[model samples]
Target: MDPHDRYTQNNFWQSSQAANAALTGCYAVLRYSGVYGGAATPLWEETASPNAYNYSNSDGWNSIAEGLQSSTTGGIISSRWANCYEGIGRCNYFLANVDRVISIDEATRTRMKGEAYFLRALFYFLLENYWGDVPLILDPPDPSTQSNLPRTSRQQIIEQILKDLDSATLVLPLKYGSSDLGRATKGAAMALKARVLLFEASPLFNTNNDKNKWKLAADAAKAVIDISSSAGYGLYPDYRSLFLPENENNKEVIFDVQFIYPQEGNSFDLICGQYNSNAPLLDLVLSYEMKNGLPITDPSSGYRPDSPYLNRDPRLYATIVYPGEVWVSGSNKVTVTSSWFPITGYAMQKLSVYNSATKPPVKASDIKDGQSYINYIVIRYADVLLMYAEAQNEFIGPDPSVYDAVNQIRARVGMPNVAPGLTQDSMRQVIRHERRIEFAGEGLYYNDIRRWKIAELVMNSPIYTWKHTLIETRRFNPNRDYWWPIPQTQLDLNHNLVQNPGY
Candidate 1:
């Protein structure tokens, strides 16, 4: 008569309807609990969030930043894969069991199916980028159904993702209305699919030179633009406003995982997590082109690299709190001076609680500390705009509409117009640079560089800079580091599971 025993399938389909609802709860856990983790998830964990302008961690020209690990285990990056897949399994369980809810109508049933498909695609997208060739569990197995979960081909996995996304898009509502603004939408599915295609076609995955892959990516992104304009999505009035508490669930966001205040335990508001390490990297802070739509590299450009953080993109100021910005933190209005970066040279105070009334009092515990309710932008209109431009430029050799899309993003930030007749290489460079600025500290740059195929060189080579010392000798370990290794534990469980190349 034990209650836990009921969760098992003793003629599950024939009797237990409520158990299926419990399954929904399982999928929801994956939907909710999995916030940022692993190297892919920015930890900015090492830097001390300074309230005043002074470099206290005086290594002089050097201070140790956090990314080094224990020689025993791979540390966090190894553990995240297990956590990601447990949630994936839960989602897969939902996918396998949802059909049992015969009481629901076809429309309701299909919507649930669509949600499942989207969740799977999302999970795989994260896995592919991080782990590369994850064991693709399309449906939940009966405990004994499969003795081993084989590693799916990364290409086959991508193909499956595209299929899921396409199905989800057709069923998901374009508008969630006021009631469900942050949930995934048809536009969200389309944009993510487009991004996936772009990644697949890019040098990151498409080992073979297939021009059709680029065409597919372009077409998918264009579909989102063709449809999303009519939906209630436009650029947020100000790029700075995009991060404010007042801007949560703005028109721009197609989907975001909403976080809440005084949020206890592991949550999306984890930058302020233990050690508060996930600070903005300096490369990200300096990459923003001046508001004139020209890069800092341009000789005529006003921005000075030595004084790089000053007078640059408005987004740079809004997203990152640098050495000398007088910013009000919470109701206390604590002035942040230069001590922000003891080692890393920047502070990410952007996603912190901005509103006075709703601000989660900075808890003393790192897990719950300084976390805010600002919804994370899973897919935003600006990203969709950029995707359209990048895809179109690659597919059609720099279409004017592509210019318009890129320019609109610039215009939103008060940047000068994108030049007409810019070449593919120039525009591609511009987009890559803009992405570093626009999505800085949002955990996109690392992937953006990787997908652009520049990371093998950029991440591999070292430059001696004013702040970082260790990076001068660091090389991107393409063999074992580009994609994280499949968790050693997962590999042990599934004999058929193959590790990625090298790792």
Candidate 2:
């Protein structure tokens, strides 16, 4: 069966339902499986490590951050950008053709169309976050239109994305049933819209503050929060379970890029973990507050860096590894670096899937099986909470609910509650820090800093200085380094496209 076939089945709305399936395939490329293959796994590492990304076939992940002159990691990034646009074209194809679902009701047709718009926007959003000034191509332009096309302004691309989100907001149901677990919903649309607005209001895009941008972001987030508390979307009881195979269709996931072992899910983990140490930095590990809301910096916390595991939040144990950390591995001990080391020395363990009791043991032969089969989260409820806090802080000046949001996350960790009477600026600092710790190693850091327009402040410092060796250390070069130069191949082929500043 050709998975790439334009159409496979007919739907009630599609004159030929096969078209909708083919169209949805456009969104599937974002998954761990699909067109880009196992190499896409490098993205998470690239975002998290540089010096540590070296080993075996892991150089690609390192090169992305180390600035290799010409590398496979660079190639993966290039191909990913191109493939994403191909997906954009597919969505354009559906938006251009969904009218064919003859028997479909007006409502279904509208919702389907809305899904397409959301997908297209998502694709562009990915591009915007990475390359900054990417060419935004809308619609399936005729051959005549292609030759004349040039890069579109980032602002223009954002405008188009907002239009799509607004369209999605009009038709999707608030929630979907079990069978429709992975499908887009009104909640997903709103969460994404709020995120986009917050990104826009962020220092990266809004640069000059522009009052209205912040207000719009606040309003968008408020709309989601208004419904989110009552909506079924929320955090899972076990933070570790969020990444486990058993939690594939959990309630906490807003939208996940579905994957199936061998078939759709290839060796994403086996390849990513080959030799590279996907280390989750120390700042990220300690950000989880003491169940009492106090930071590890609090003297009352009795947080012994030596015995960090004794009384810290459970999530710390779930998401990170400190000395003596042990996970099941066949008959071997899956040990963590000894606690003798400093925080950054601890490696990230959030994606671990090594238990043999409840699940199949990792086969030395089939590395993929050793990894979890859970779907990769494309967007989760936790992100919405962060977005809500960020937007609210920016608009409302760190209201009590800001602490409410932060504490909710801390509560799960069994830490003390955060102190009240904090300024918006101070609370925003904590949220940003907390997000770094919470979402570490999940492909968020780079974008998080960029959106905050604090890339220079964060990346400009010594980023990955391996304390033990000269083998890995890097300095962020802002002028020529912020964005990868347009792929050399694209530059050679598309004379119409221009490179970003200082590239």
Candidate 3:
């Protein structure tokens, strides 16, 4: 018998250890490049929106941003589709066989099954968001029967996703021991459910202006907020420290994809800092409010065009490395002509651990590829608060609860409370703008613009550098660009698969 092939398919699921290993395999898929794996994959997603620009076409996001994406748009379009289904297949196999492990305790088995359900739902959620309709394969793959499966409606897939989350919430623990810190938890399931409901209720999906859908979304988000204390979830006090590796699994983080150096690492610092692959656009930089919580365009806001970076939102300084900004150390300033960043004249500062404050400061030469191990936060308490505010405001104007939720986020960063007694339409813009500033460089803006159906307006404009130099003019087709084309390779494999319109 071959020592490497110690167990065959028939014997693999017979023990508790084997069952755990199988479940772990399901989680491993999240680390794939197509999924939320490396720093580049998630951060590069901003390139698809107006928040950032990718200088190179190698990642496929530059092409998509330029309105040049097609069935052959190979990088993210193909990988995301393939990796998500690959995750689904692994989860399906684990769920199908884990029950065979009689050595496991009933409670442990239940929790393990809950994890499998959550992973499957997450993978499906990615598919629903990007592809709209996809092959809903819940069982272990059988080439004979599953090879030619047709697309399932997104509504049906969402129903199944919610069902799985409900099941997960019942069995997953509110908190795990330190040894299992990064595993899925009950709070994570509820938080993900809130996000799913909010997206479903958005204008992109609920086209009839359905108030009831917004209420469902508001209630779902409120449910998570209600359990925040018991679940040990809240805003991490310092905005800049929140992304540091030392702050991983902080109270603010509801769910995050964990990474560790040597064993498992990412190229976040190298690609985002040195290469400037995902450069913050001038449009995003200008969206930040002044220190007094007023728009820069406001006459009384104290935002000077010449000294643009001074007296800006604190989060702006925390998130972006602009020209003349102190970078690695207090004395090390980023000059305008620095070759380290030449794309958009701005580089991402968040999610990198190379600052002067460290015991041994990390220099530019010290940064290496696939060595940064910062955990990528997927959902957090701040997002829940934002979702609740947005959904509730849409459902019943700007209620007191809406004010409280929005104000809490602002208070954490030392900004003033949202202006009192604003009309519903005005408050809507406030919540949207707050999200743009709050979640900048975190890869959420692209979906926000799409769900709000404002992509055509924002993405069709010209992207510029900090000096107001035109970088490129982007395009967004209202009819087809809203949904990416199914990969042409997938179409070749499955004749039943149809391409999205305008491809």
- lDDT tens readout by residue for model 2, 1-503: 53555534343234545655755677677665433345565334434332123333242455555545241245456766776787788788778767876767788778888888888888888787667778777777455776446888888888999999998988888777777666777777887887888888888678788767877877776677677665677788777777877787777787677666655664544432332245544445556666555678989977786666666666666765555666554666555444323324554455545332233324446474324345667677778777778887887788877778777776665655667888888888888877876676566766777677665555433443223333344455556555655666666667888876665
Residue 466's lDDT in candidate 2: 26
Highest-scoring model, TM-score: 3
Tens digits of per-residue lDDT for model 3, 152-215: 9988999999999999999999999899978999999999999999998899988999999999
What TM-score fits each model?
0.83, 0.85, 0.96
Tens digits of per-residue lDDT for model 1, 1-503: 53555655534544335544644544444323343432223333222111111123211101212112211244344545655666667667777776675666778667767776787788788888776776777667554755486767787888888899989999988876675554567888888998898888787777786778888888887787788667778888877677766778878887766555554122334453223355444555546777665678898888775776666778777666566555444554444444534434555555654222233324435345334456566678888888877777777777788888888888887888877788998888777766666676565666666676665565443332226543333345555545655656766767787766654
- Rank by lDDT (best first): 3, 2, 1
For each of the candidates, the C-alpha root-mean-square deviation to the true structure, in angstroms, is 5.4, 4.5, 1.9
- Candidate number with the higher lDDT (1 or 2): 2
Q: Using TM-score, rank the candidates from best to worst.
A: 3, 2, 1
Q: All candidates' lDDT scores?
A: 0.61, 0.65, 0.87
Candidate 1 residue-wise lDDT at 172: 85
Q: Model 1, residue 42: displacement in angstroms?
A: 5.0
Whichever of 1 and 3 has more lDDT, that candidate is 3
